[model samples]
Target: MTPGMQIRLWLRQASKTQVGVTAVALAGVVVLLVASLTTGGHHRASTSVAAGAGAATNTGQGALAPATPEGGTGTAPVAGGTSGAAAVVSAPTTGGAAAVPGAGGTTAATAAGGTTGATGQTAGPLTASDRGVTPTTVKIGFLIANVGGLDQGGFALGLRTDIGQAIDAFVDDANKHGGMAGRKVVAVKRTEDPTNQGDLKAACDYMLRDQQVFGVVDSASNIYAATQRCYTIDNKTPLAHVYALSADFMTAGGGYDMTTTPNLDRIAKFVGAAAKQMGFVKGGEHVGIFTDACEPSNTVIRKVMAPAFKADGAATVDIAQTDCDPQAQTSQVPNAVLQMKTKNVDRMFMATSFVGVQNFLTNADAQQFHPKYFASDYDGMAADLFTKNFPPTQWDRTQGISSGYSGWLRAGHGLTPAQKRCSDILVAHGLPAMKDDAANGEVISQCDAFLNIMVPAAKAAGANLTRAGWAQASQRLGHVDVAGFQSCTYAPGKYSCGDSYASVEWRKEFQGYIQISGYRPANA
Candidate 1:
């Protein structure tokens, strides 16, 4: 039996459920939210983020005026912008970028501690702007993970507060340095219940409609595609997402929505590449891929992942699906295990979310099946979701590829320039500097998106700060200084600027995951 099999079984019980509420309804039965979240409640006014905020509870001022879902929802990524991607920006910048000040003449430190800007292109907004931009303030929305009534303990205590402090501290630091386009960033904050689609849409609407934010920054909280659409598509606002955005969000966003992490296709592509690079999956091995039956997940499994494994020379590839049902996910695990075992799958990629990963890991062990696992940060593998559920084991031959940086992985190498700057800002605000992946690296992500990404992109927008200009300006940034990756590059359809993915491994000694290899390029 695995070391964590006992505890994993305990946590997998029905009593404790952060797996998220039913995302879809079938014949009056509730299911989904493994993806494909449901929005099936009675039509009510868009309430604020006070209803059942998760671990990161919302600190709402007041409920905004109720509104209805608007028409004209759209989709695609940088790699589809609002306009055609081909016409937007140049190809991505390769290798290290030299020091060039980000917009507003603010300097950014490179990996080697030298100063540089995200891009060298001299870009300034060409049109007049008035929406959410002011001479003194650039209002943006922050969607927080505020799970109402959940007892969030351990390093996750005050989850929302920590992120708030991290964001606020960065905002203060940015203002002190040279505000975006010479305008102070006034962030409009909203917390949402990640489990509830209604709350997700309401929170999104409040920010774009009531608060009139320039763009929405949500590094925490993974809600339904419809809610994401409410921002990037229906609202026609730019969004900086932590998770992968599907074609639904991207096409509707018209290239307005992007993840700070690698995109869906890039994630699957790199996982296969990383596994092969790590020798975890060798040529001719029968590989099994377990994924949720939802957009982005299943879509990439067929279009990106399976082909990737085959390209890596796998003899055969077996794809399995989880129906986004909490009960079905666990109940079907043994059968899935049977399939993998029967197929002699010794290399597997588990792309399921929190509950799915936890259940499968335990079941695979109980069934006497052990396969080297390849995962991504998107699986919530690096989050607190992993910390409490299980510990690393021999079977945890678990390795991952991610575009985002986590300080927990900065053991022998110390802090990167991006992490150091974020820590310093936190310390400046009387908050203890983050020394590890406490809060799973959410602080670093928020800092990266808000300070490094948004600040420069907004500045590139010049005196005007329209949504389209910001999206274009951000996508065009050739290279950027970010928290964890080797290089950060951007192009029209490639909205996220991660130029490389760092190979990480779950090390028992560190009690966390670490970067085991140097940077690997997206195209590599």
Candidate 2:
């Protein structure tokens, strides 16, 4: 039997044996659990670092208040304001040994005393002595936040999982088609404590130095800019980066280190746009935003809602902060929800993770308080998972926004050309589904805006993937064009691309199946 088959056989045989018969059985379970937990933690830390990086990358602070489902309207990411001009920024600059195209590119070895090119582009083709570069066998490390306790981090984690599933499908199909020019793409993961810098550093060190990964991808926060920039500069590992957070957050406080996915803000805007589309925007329309200051994602909700609340004019936006830990912060959210009800509030904008939102929705329902609930992508991802743990009441009240690429896949929206290519790869590989792919396609469109405008021009003189090459690759993306590919590009100075997020509203079939109902682009 093959090694994998033998391991499976051993596990199967061991399942029937008690510890009395084989102590190894008990050890195996323990080992698996520990490994899983460690991986999960690393992913979480990676998410935080990404969030912070975004925050550090921007220049202003605009807060958004949550909108209520009752009558208050919020704002969407329209193409006005300073976000359109788009700034050109350099990749994080670092000191390292200079690396030429072909010198030390053969193996996954970091050249000793090597200096990275100033281009800041995450990946470039350096002719290796080997046959050629293959997308398969190219393992990329994805670090995100998914620990159970933090709501924002947890939702982002769920989104990451969805993205991973898509990539897996894409690679499976690619291998069938003879792989990425003959190499199969494989993905690995790591998690870290999103709340701490030290943890973020530790996770990075392990993935980069120890694992010697080819590159790193993240659905990360802006807060992680410092570390991420450091890696980009030091490693010359071209990143297929996803700037999921909003441009507003990046500029907050002359640029703080707290960033998240742009989708988070876009989702919040959908809350407002949906309410307005339903005629909930008028004087005396009560809306409120609730965020867990203890969590970084909530900060994003507030930022997305600020200008939106001001723009709505008729809606009254109130802000409330909560603790990340629900058990310890019992009554904090329920009380806030009750306060909104007392004010005759009609809608709410939530900047919470799935677990936190699930709890708040349950508490609000038990109290017999009903209001139109709207949240960012953080809440939407766990919409299905929430049903498994919470009651049915939430299904009828909640609506949220998500990335177009992932949201389209999850809602079974029509596939684009790019998504189709990605899907074909999955089918060829014998993988189960492409329902959750979140990486690939025009996602790089968002990143392209930045890459196209960076200060020094990231493309090296002899670079294989030129600006034209990158742009052409991105243009081919369709909902079904490529299988589950949903990555954005990042060049030198500029970071965010203007691709707004897609929105989703929950519906109950009354027969126990709660699923996505109202879906659209939250623009206007």
Candidate 3:
């Protein structure tokens, strides 16, 4: 039988008990095939996505090398190595332009009017700017999670809502400030069930083909890399910001990521260094890694994290894997915790979804096995979630890494000017008295990208803007201070922007995670 037929037969043979397992296995096979095809046998050292922070690979050390200049082809040595850099050729400034080669030797300029210049040797400026742009308005699309949908699962719906509101507020503020290049900024919003591939593809198609948006800004989703492959890769539509963990988005080469989370390697190094500093790894504590099988990024992170912990003097390394399906995870958590307890894991690292973390914690608490927990921002260990679900005793033992400047707004931990501005904008947009939470941070992050990165790049692209022009303009943004929150940079070959993060620990008195260390670059 053919491989496809075999897969179908195997799927059919799977009992109800094995359905989730079979589905996860099939998904893995599909991802591996896609990765092989997309990478073209030229795999980068790491698989951390460009722009957004959280999914990481081994960076060797904490510090990243300087970015490649606009005209250079050398890749940036950021958190994820050479693959972190997406090659971006400089747009012609003087006479005309040339059709640059995109990923897989595809013509970078396929849209109408994106032809060669008068010289025929070089491509010309964009003329047919009708897609998502007009003399008075520029349309952008937003793809975010459907909070009230059936697939909400473990995602923090409040955070997604805050991000959506922040986008609205940013667009309103931009229009008030003369808009982007004399056109009012308008956002078209779409919600998707993140776990549903059909929903994600439909959303992408609607935004790119039907809405004809100039660009897309996607919030956190597990399947964002797949969406990029299905839509943006062939269409050449630039994605403004993505908060997913997959590194393929950067290496595939098309858009930019505004992520603050360093690559997995950097995260691993950070965890090791932080644990050592915090006395958890002094005499080599037993370390365990918990990961979700469904999220590909988590798999990459778990592989790197274990070795890094060992290199940093972990006494023993144990691993417990679980599925991302809520029901399956609920059943798996007790067994996973039991294994960890039996192994006497003193310090454990989690590379799973926020929901997965909650399940593990709930089970751990029941078993009275209180081990120190380490995680990255992607795990959704926000202060609010901890306060609501976990007791002070449970949360106080949790330490995680974050790319933001401050913890969720606390009384003594004042907000930076940019953060305050984000809060004010949210209030003005009718989200009054928004509490300090992960959602608030999500808002600030997206707003910072809109204000500091996307708007500036759009302005730089000048009149008669096209998707290609927007991307070229984005490439020119070498390094920029993001409203005092963090620093971001891009170049001809680099798309992973932020290169630093801070270590935070949960504090009961403050009711949130507090920054224990100052903002440190990936390189120690």
- By lDDT, the best candidate is 1
Candidate structures ordered by lDDT, highest first: 1, 3, 2
Give the count of colliding residue pairs in each prediction.
31, 128, 22
Instruction: State how far residue 476 of model 3 sits from its true place (Å).
Output: 3.3
Q: What TM-score would candidate 1 get against the native?
A: 0.73
Per-residue CA lDDT of model 3 for 270-299, tens digit only, reads 566666666666766888876544433443
Worst 10 residues of 3 by lDDT: 1-10
Please give the CA lDDT of all the candidate structures.
0.54, 0.35, 0.50
TM-score of structure candidate 3: 0.69
Compute the lDDT of residue 201 as modeled in candidate 3: 58
In terms of TM-score, how similar is model 2 to the real structure?
A: 0.53
Model 2 gets an lDDT of 0.35
Candidate 1: regions farther than 4 A off = 1-128, 148-160, 247-252, 382-388, 391-394, 406-410
Question: Cα deviation in Å at residue 151, candidate 1?
Answer: 3.0
